[model samples]
Target: MIAFLKKRAKMSFLLLLKVLRFYWLLLNVWHFSRTKISYEAVKWRNISIYFHFKSKIIKYLTSNILSKINISLNSSNKNFSSYIK
Candidate 1:
């Protein structure tokens, strides 16, 4: 009976150790996944901001060019009309 009890105790101890190791592995996996997700979020946000700023710059430049063209056309029309008169 004593030998049987000793064997059972050892088995229980080994089971407990295996459970602890499994939990440790699960915790590490959870931590790594969370970190990876946060890193990707930040990286995508920066890329979106960069594209937004680039679009704004292009819009501003095009608008300026259009206004300048309108001004030059109006001036030329006035000069031509005056010359004809």
Candidate 2:
């Protein structure tokens, strides 16, 4: 029983070490990046910047169309489930 407990204890210690190592790696990468921005976040940020710039061209046209259509600005998409994958 004592030997089995020692083996279990050693396994638990090794698992804890592995988890700490993984966390340390993530922290090291975050520190190196200095902004905590992951690859996907950077990609999305670039896309948002592009879209914002493009929106300026349509801003006037959309406003005129909206006024003519008389659509309420407060209305939202009630079928939220369609947005989920």
Number of residue pairs clashing in candidate 2, backbone atoms closer than 3 angstroms, sequence gap of 3 or more or interchain? 0
Question: lDDT of each prediction vs. the true structure?
Answer: 0.85, 0.75
**Superposed model 2: Cα runs more than 4 Å off:** 35-85
Highest lDDT: give the candidate number.
1
lDDT at 30 for candidate 2? 72
Model 1 agreement with the true structure over 21-83: per-residue lDDT tens digits: 798658656765877756566557658977999999999999999999999999999999999
TM-score, one value per model: 0.51, 0.40
Candidate 1: residue 37 lDDT (0-100): 55
The TM-score measured for candidate 2 stands at 0.40
Q: Note the residue pairs that clash in candidate 2.
A: none
* CA displacement after TM-score superposition, residue 28 of candidate 1 (Å): 23
